[model samples]
Target: MPYAPKHPCTYPGCATLVDAGNGRCERHRIQERRELDRQRGSPAARGYGSRWRKARREFLRQSPLCAQCYVLGILRAATVVDHVIPHKGDSKLFWNQSNWQSLCKRCHDKKTVQDGRWK
Candidate 1:
């Protein structure tokens, strides 16, 4: 018997019906997979930018103790300023000091990954 499917493609406006097991029609599924690949392959998604590097050094010199680490009982010494909300599309977010926080490399990376800070 031919297999029926479930969970049609989640692409923005795609209307092609999906399969019972995979959740998407063949074409829509391929498109979705490609999009996922692109997202994963993006430069920004890989890590910080040149601007972030510059800002990080200056921030670290100004404040060396990781704030969140202290709060979390980690006591990590080295720290970097991380934007609470990324400044990617909104350059105005770059200079908003209030939106910045000091965090250890480990905590910063974990927070960004767990909560998708740069993503």
Candidate 2:
């Protein structure tokens, strides 16, 4: 099979040619990922440390079915513990068990988009 033509790296002034599948060159790709990670901070820094993990495990064990799926007459196994309300750096809200819901990945992703958190 013939390969797709190579294209210039889409990182500003760099003219390095890369495969069509990659928008940026390898170097630029690494740089972009590092920048994103720096801006995003570590999971612990965002308050999902050991305490959150233990609480999440217990919550999932007690509520094994997706809340949204249950509402829709489905019985999907839940994998994510989502905040009913966005914490947005509020420690009190972040640790509120009453504001938590068990959700499957699909339902959780949909809810995240609806909550304007994925954009």
Candidate 3:
């Protein structure tokens, strides 16, 4: 099967050709991730510690399909457990199982963008 064609990195002034689906070259990707991490703080600081990991795993096991996609009549496998309402550092809200929903990466990203959580 033919692979997707390479394209220039999306980083401004970067002429590096990267595989399709990647917006930035490897170096820029690392730089961008580091910058994001610096701005967002560590996962543990953001309430995503071992406990969150365990809960996420159990939730995903119980709800394997993306809730948003399922509502749209699709059966996409979920890889993310999203909080229906932004917790905004509220531990009670963060831990509320009723506020959680399974979502695939694409749906999660779209929701994040819509929620103004992604920069």
Q: Write the per-residue lDDT of candidate 3 for residues 12-114, one digit (tens) a residue.
A: 9999999988899999999997998898899999999999999999999999999999999999999999999999999999999999999999999999999
Highest lDDT scorer: 3
Candidate 2 lDDT over 1-119, as tens digits, reads 99999999999999999998889999999998888889989999999999999999999999999999999999999999999999998999999999999999999999999998653
Number of the top TM-score candidate: 2
Between which residue pairs do clashes occur in model 3? none
Clashes of each: 5, 0, 0
Q: Which ten residues in a row have the lowest lDDT in candidate 3?
A: 110-119
| lDDT score at residue 40, model 1, on the 0-100 scale | 62
Worst 10 residues of 1 by lDDT: 39-48
> Which one wins by lDDT: 2 or 3?
3
Give the TM-score of each candidate.
0.50, 0.72, 0.71
Model 1 spans with C-alpha error above 4 angstroms: 1-52, 117-119
